[model samples]
Target: MYQPLAYRLRPKTLEDIVGQEHLVGPGKIIRRMVEANLLSSMILYGPPGTGKTSIASAIAGSTSFAFRMLNAATDTKKDLQIVAEEAKMSGTVILLLDEVHRLDKTKQDFLLPHLENGRIILIGATTENPYISINPAIRSRTQIFEVHPLTPEAIEMALDRALTAKDGFKDEDVILEQSAKRELAFVTNGDLRSALNALELAVRSTPKNEDGTILITKEIIQECTQQKGFSHDKNGDAHYDVISAFQKSIRGSDADAALHYLARLIEAGDLISICRRLLVIGYEDIGLANPAAASRTLDAVLAAERLGLPEARIPLSVAVLDLCLSPKSNSAYQSLDRALQDVKNGKATTIPNHLKDSHYKGAAALGRGLTYQYPHEFSDGWVAQQYLPDPLAHTRYYEPKFTGRYEQALAKRYEELHQKKSSSTK
Candidate 1:
């Protein structure tokens, strides 16, 4: 059976792994474990194509242990039993369990005792957070290490190696242009497997030149990657991460960074998410400080909805730029949160009698609106009177933040009313 370039080029030792120096580098915990021949069951969590399986295979190779592969979601208990039997025969085995978070009770029970006795060194690999997704029983039995996405530099190094490695296209006259290599590395977004797959596709599909060399160019890579440069999986962790970065970039007042994230979301065709998050950022991050910017954000969102994608990005970009440059303040919502907390805590919450409705004849008889003072009846359209419940009459919640001209005026009016109330009380 023909193997993929990625599978064929799998690193056989810790030293040969492309990224994850913290785990596979010299003197690291994993490298140390292999060096001492004292292996243990561990879970490796990270985004796909970041060397989790490679690490498992390398460990098995380095230790000369029996290596077996199985998918926790798809493999049956019988398959696990086969590995267990092999472990008993060989004394030990390194098992790479993919999507280990999906391990069912049946398979887990069968594997537990083997793991405990060190008969099978379990290397559980997952793209999900082990703490949140894996069972506590399994989690407690293994040390968890996070694998990070490979950096562009690390991916470039891997691409360079693949062009000449024996298991790669070394024998073929595959002339990968420097720019093409960078493009492949850039488009894959730190996924070495994706880069290798694209590289293989480009090499096989492109016709050879007169000199008998398969010339891979930037155009060829772009075609092979199919505009995967801004690939986004809407149901994956990266979706939330990108949205978080998008909002944070706007909150940090970095228009360039905000637009970059916006572009990624645009490529994903996620106009609704873009609109929703921008609307939230307007109120949550830029409230009161630049209310006009918030209003314009709404307008841009409306325009985006009317126009749909491609052109929608224009209004979205305008809104993002406006928000990124707006004066930021969360005090408006923060004050409401304080008041909400008081309500949730069940603090004294009876409505003051004077502030209650007095429109009905029976309301006056019930002591409603008896001492109420209408602010509009005063000369300045303002008056000092109790509005809060008795227990919270003196409590303060709306602490104004004067981050912009508009909020500065609001703060002035707020202080004026506070002073008048104090004087009235005296």
Candidate 2:
């Protein structure tokens, strides 16, 4: 049976692991543990292909502990029992639990005692944030370490090693171009497993030249990965991640990063998501700080909608650039939210009697509008009167921001009105 290149290239020792220098580098925590031959239960969380499993395997390999792999979601309690039995017989078994965030209460209970006793050194792996997804009982017992995506330089280094490694194309005559290596390294977006697999596929599928050497080109790498990083999966976790990055980039005023994520969304054909998020960012982030820019954002979104697709990206790009460069303020929505929270808490809801409708005949009998003072009838077209209910007569909301000239002017008028209201009440 032929093993996959990634499987064949699994890191057999801590020294062999690539990337994640923070955890695996010299003088790092994991490296120190391995050097001292003291292994503890750990949860390694990160995106897939970032070497969570590889790190687990390397730990077991280095420590000389019995290694076993199982899926927390698919495996039953009986499967865990088997590992427990093996730990009894072998003294200690290093169990690499995949998708550990899905471990149910029953399995977690069964595994806890074993982890405590050190009979089974648990190396839980997950692609989700363990703090949010994993049960607290299990979390409290294990040391959680985060794994990050491998850098392009790290991937390139791995590709270079794979070219000459015994299990790779060392036996066969193959020549890999520098451009091809860089393309393979980059197109996978820091996914070393994907890069290795794509490299293997390219090497195997291409025919040998007259000199009997398989020459791999950048085009070959792209063909192998089928557009790789350029193509976005709209239904995957990466989709939401990209959307989050898109909005945050704009909010942070990083125009380049915003455009990069926007381009990804565009390529994925997620015009609806792109347009909706842009509209939200315009108001929620730009708000009173740059009202005109917010209005222009809506206009750009409308243009994009009418244009649709390839042409739509043009207008969307212009809108994203504007929003990123515009002054940001969330005060408008934040003030509304503060008022909403008061209402939800049952702080105040009744309208003042004076402000109530009095156009109806029976309203006067109910004392509605009895003390009403119409602002239009006043000389200054303004009057200070109780607008809030008795319980919240002095309640104030709508705190204007001063991040831009527009909001600064609004803030000035707001203070003036507040002062007039305060003096009249006195």
Best candidate, lDDT-wise? 1
**TM-score, candidate number 2:** 0.84
Q: What is the TM-score of each candidate against the true structure?
A: 0.84, 0.84
Candidate 1 residue spans exceeding 4 A from truth: 33-41, 64-66, 77-93, 101-121, 129-143, 169-175, 202-224, 346-377, 389-391
Residue-level lDDT of model 1, residues 237-346, one tens digit each, is: 67888999999999999999999999999999999999999999999999999999989999999999999989999999999999999999998999999999999999
Candidates' lDDT values, in order? 0.92, 0.91
Candidate 2 regions exceeding 4 Å error are: 36-38, 104-106, 207-212, 235-237, 292-308, 340-376, 388-396
- Model 1 shows how many backbone clashes? 0
lDDT of 2 by residue, 1-426 (tens): 999999998999988899999999999999998899888899998777889999998998898789999999999999999999999999999999999998999999999999999999999999887888899999998999999888999999998888889988789888999999888878898788999999999999999999999999989998999864664667555678899999999999999999999988998999999999999999999999999988888999999999999999988998999999988899999999998999899987789989999999899999999999989999989999988888888777888878889999988998998899999888
| Candidate that scores best on TM-score | 2
